[model samples]
Target: MAETVGDYVLQRLREWGVQQVFAYPGDGINGIVTAFGRAGDDPHFIQARHEEMSAFQAVGYAKFSGRVGVCMATSGPGAIHLLNGLYDAKLDHVPVVAIVGQTERSAMGGAYQQEVDLQALFKDVAGDYLVEVNVPEQLPNAIDRAFRTAMSRRAPTAVIIPSDVQEEAYTPPAHAFKQVPSSPPGLTRPAAVPSAPDLRRAAEVINAGSRVAILVGQGARAAAAEVQQVAEATGAGVAKALLGKDVLSDDLPYVTGVIGLLGTRPSYELMRDCDTLLIVGSNFPYSQFLPEFGKARAVQIDLDGSMIGMRYPTEVNLVGDAAATLRALLPLLTGTPAKAWREKIEAGVAGWWRTMEQQSMVNADPVNPMRVVWELSERIPHDAIVTADSGSAANWYARLLRVRGEIRGSLSGTLASMGPAVPYAIGAKFAHPDRPAVAITGDGAMQMNGMAELLTIARYAHRWADPRCVVCVLHNNDLNQVTWELRAMGGAPKFEESQQLPDVSYADIARAMGLDAITVRSPDELGPAWDRALGAGRPTVIDVYCDPEVPPIPPHVTLEQASSRLRAVLKGDPGGLHLVVQGAKTKLREVLPGQDR
Candidate 1:
């Protein structure tokens, strides 16, 4: 049988060394589905419960594997469903290629069923690159460009294949004038370094300051050792952005945890007290958390020149790969390590961890959500890949969990979208089938999509070499994050119609789907539940009933936030009394004797 366009597409993907493609079936891609069957599932097709979940899984796979992720969908609704996750990949700077099927070319202009103007629809999300393959001759170059652009720009790109065109006989581009041919599949990455002058200037600024602070993001993942070397040389306190949570181990005494509203107190102080700031590979958006505008002489190192010097006023901007640039700068740095400053930062980090423990122990009606993550932190394997969905769950994951060893963690950092945790874990499993993957999610997100993805896990659980995929659901029957945001940010009381979630037994549902399930109502049960789930031979779900009234208090609360909370309580917030009690208890841990400034 002669090769078809769909067959050639898969062949190109194989040439690019793609191991899997996350997708869902639809009639719009009938040709491709048939081709997949004919190809014997080479570059395996990993079916997701939804197109959005497929895109997110691809993003997660790309994030963990350091390779371009690919997701496929059918026309119209399926393509539309992919936008949110594609946007998540775009915003978080993850490379993902979306292959979407379109209506038959003949029926496109006549508004055939499932026909949509996919180019206009995907223009923004896949702004880096978007193309429609109208003929078989466009195959190799179009698909190759999609993958190449997505990887080079670290953004989502798209390729639209018309249904009829997918069935056409494959044809290579001719050696004639108008045909475009692509080079063989493989990208060679260069280690970019800044100019000698910029490195010297950055080194000079670091050498001149008595108190130095360094901030890192996901971009710093490859440069962890170099970051530590710089910290030792300059006696700088290192703080991570949420996306860079796993870049450095929390066990490092001088490593202040995440820096932002959900960041550690030591991180806040590290930014506030520093005389000089060094931002490496992090585009952390919260400028208010950094040192006052003119107080600190700042230097930034990033691979993208467009992003440099935008967040803060920097004395020197070095556009280069983080590890290579830092390696170059190391020899130029002549700073004397400030023992006193390093000691103070270490002391603050120690106190902050103590405060986190105290906060986790605070009483709640059922379980303090913080305690759930704290317990997991105690038992999570060294090589586990942990994912957290957005909401109050992120607060606990950010503050309570400590990442060490080869552990990798990420979320919708820039987009802050919910429902990616479970899918991300699914993608992580594909990325590393030998390692255990865990997802921390809230009830709202679990109901939104996490629950459906459990079936996907159950379906694929048998394929994993180490089948310990655990989804820990914070079963608080409330949209807890937005509920707190309404009170703290808008001074509005919790509107139950929108804030309250209908309770569902996630564990029961998981068991029904042929996976291990554990339910925890008491704080003491959390540790044992986690152990069982982690040791389980298959996928597991731990549904812990959490306190909806527990507030995710920020490290540094402003008077305005306090006033808003007070106004919310006075304005008849439903959980007013319980909210006050929990908030006060959670915050009290910070001022305790052992948690000294």
Candidate 2:
């Protein structure tokens, strides 16, 4: 049989090393779907319950494997549903390729059913590349460029294939599709390294400062050892952006936890007190968490030149690959370590961890969410891959989960959207079949997507020999994060209509999907529940009933936030009063004899 446009597209995708393509079947995409079926399992096709989940699973695959993820959807609504997850990939700087099926060329733009302007719909989210197969011959080049651009730019790209174009015969003599391919595909260019002059300038800035702090993000994933080397040589305290949490271990003496509201007190102190801030691979947008511009000199190193001065003004900007840049910059620096600075940072880290341990141990009626996260942190295997959804669940995850050695995970960083954890866990499990994959999500986020995703997990549970996928649902029966945000942001009253969530049995939902499920109503059952899920040898869900009143208190709260808490308490919110009391309790610690007081 002669090759079709759909066959060429799938062939190119296989050449690009796309092992798994998240896809949903539809009439408009039947040709491509059939082509995928003919290709066998080299590039396995994963069927998602929703188009959104398909795209999100792609994002998760990219994040865990450090490779470009691919997703396919049908025309109109299916394509539109991909926008959110694609935007998550874009904002998080992960590579993803989206192949969307479009209406037949003849039916487009004539008030026909399911006819959407693909280019216009994807303009903002898929900024790196977006093109339609208007001409049958254009499919080959479009597919090539879309994957290439996505990998190079670390952003999402889109290719729209019209139904007619997909079915066109590929008898190519005048087109490049049948021509001799140059160098076979899938070869990628190496990332640029820092120049000598940039290294010298960066070294000079670091050498002049007595107190240096190193902040890293996902860009530094490959440079963890080099980052430690630079920190040791320069006597710098290391602070991780949320995306870089796993780059360094929490127990490391010089390593401070993440920065921002989901960050640690010691990390805030390091940022505030450092004389020179060296930012590598992170475009953390919370400038307020950084030291004032004039107060501290800054040096930024990133693969993207445009992102160099984006987060903070830099005295030195080194545009290059993170590991290479760090390696080059190390030799130019003075080897003198600042002993006093290191001691101070170590002391601060110790104090902060003590406080964290205390907070994580607090027993509250209805199980405390922090205790659940803390217990899981202690029990997870060394090679586990963990994920967390947005909302109050993130608070416990950010604060309690410690990433060390081979243990790694991710959260929705810039996009901060909910409903990705369940799918992300499935993706992560697929990416590393032998590693334990866990998803931590809230009641609201679980209900939003977890129910459908439970089926996705059950479908693929038998594919991998090791069945260690777990979903920990924090069942608080409220939009707990937003409820706290309303009070913390000074909103007058908590609107019950928008803030409360219906009580539902996530365990039952998981069980109905043929997953091993357990529900824990008390803290005593937490450890055993986690152990059971970890050893279930199948996809499992642990529905934990958590306290709804625990506030995700920020390390630093503004006066306006304080006012908001007061107002919320005055307006008769019991949860607000709990927050206020917690604040007072924290303050009272300063007056205790064995503490800082």
Candidate 3:
């Protein structure tokens, strides 16, 4: 007469397009674990040793399949461990459902065993959270909300499932719940563009400006064609925010390059030289690169009303979607392509490509960041989903690795956290088992994240990309980059401790977990190691001993930030002191390498 809670959840998940649930079991979730075992078929159960990896695995799976990724963990520290990975999903806009088993409702408040304020802890990171503590029927809507939120916002959603209730029996629905939609998404566009006055002002600025540039962001992904048209017709050039890289063809004539610290010089110079800059989509974070207030006129079009003037000031704030806004701007422009200025932007773009070709060939003895990621881009299948960790890893990936369209990817576009890559890779793999998935992680990222997720890869061990997924550990094994930043900011400790992390032999860790693993000592060994990883498929671990100091932040970063973080360290704030001595900031880029070129 009574059905267990796990069955109820699993049964509903199947109807919702969630085929599997990844999680690490614990005493806290005994009932759910038992229920999962008894759930027969359909929504399969995945066992991950570490809670963090369970969430990571979900991220990887979600990327390709475009399905809802589900991962579970027991209450207390176990559930807490999943937060970092969840934050990753939230930041990258992955539609993930994290089912956390809470402490028995009775002992929850007092911390029965490993309990903490799980909801409060996760609040800052997740796009939203759902706590299901009551009637079983209520779960369907909560689940529905999680799925819908994830898709609409492209972020992670948390579902806290209490332990006592996990096994509680309930009637099964005669039919399954509605499936989650993953693709061919829609948007609500305003019937009209900005007011006539604003449009007139923007037009006047465009008319007066000889050299104009257009900067696009992640929101421009859907408006690629419209954006390209505007660029071509107006003699305007294109500069992209990091998330906008794949929005347009890399070789588009008017695209100079990405603009930011990881960005190329061409984009920067173009932005500086251009008289008017049109921001198609994005509240791009970096104001440093934006034209100084009085220097040049800038216009921004966005869907969110609150986004206007959130970061860089805008002369014209058009409240509309990117596609529609561009379409509106297209007709207003009477000027033919200004051949001279257009030629200038094109030259800069051509120079960047030329620079890329020249530097990619640089055979540095120790192996450079550019070569590592460039070669990786070349070696990995074009369709492979490349997930990246924060820090130097992002910079390396941003500059060297080329994303072949919106194949598959997950990264903290704004938050820029580490550790997400590993968990995201797991999620991506689960969502799309048929596609090759890989995660690029720096030593700092793995150190902060659960190393045990490597074990999760071996559990399903499905043959997708044969060695369908691989982890390339850029093993500088230290937070050297952060320490330098701290030191520069005048915060580094006088007696800087060698915060270098002990060499983590991921190969050994992977082998211990029954996964194929290899460690490359030099550039020469990298190819062979990759071949083994790729050739054998299944999940393989490739740990490469590369320099952590070789960051991807523009070399100008070496000049140091205006605030001397190191000088602050010398002033003796113990926590601050520890970070500086530990070289924490040095590892900030976990993905952004030092000398990417």
> CA lDDT, every prediction?
0.93, 0.86, 0.69
The regions of model 2 sitting more than 4 angstroms off are 173-183, 582-597
Q: Tens digits of per-residue lDDT for model 3 on 1-597?
A: 477767767766777767788877887778778776777745777777678777777766765565667888887888887876677677656678887777777787774777777678667766465555544555566666777777655678877777777767764333456422222223333444677677777777776677888898876777889988878777998887886776676667677667788787777887777878888777688887877777788788876676676766677788877787677777777766789999988887776665554454444435555556767766767567778887777777677665565455546677676677877777677666677777888788777763667766776665344447788887776664565445555545423455567776888888888877888776777667766777775678787777543434452454455245545544763445444323333333232333432
Candidate 2 local Cα displacement, residue 278, angstroms: 0.4
Sort the candidates on lDDT, descending order.
Answer: 1, 2, 3
Candidates ranked by TM-score: 1, 2, 3
Lowest-scoring 10 consecutive residues by lDDT in candidate 1? 588-597
Best by lDDT: 1
lDDT of 2 by residue, 164-277 (tens): 888888644353455432335674668688778878988999999999999999899999999999999999999999999889888799998889898888889999999999
Q: What is the Cα-based lDDT of residue 422 in candidate 1?
A: 98
Off by over 4 Å in 1: 593-597
Candidate 2 residue-wise lDDT at 472: 94
Q: Which whole-number lDDT from 0 to 100 does residue 563 have in model 1?
A: 98
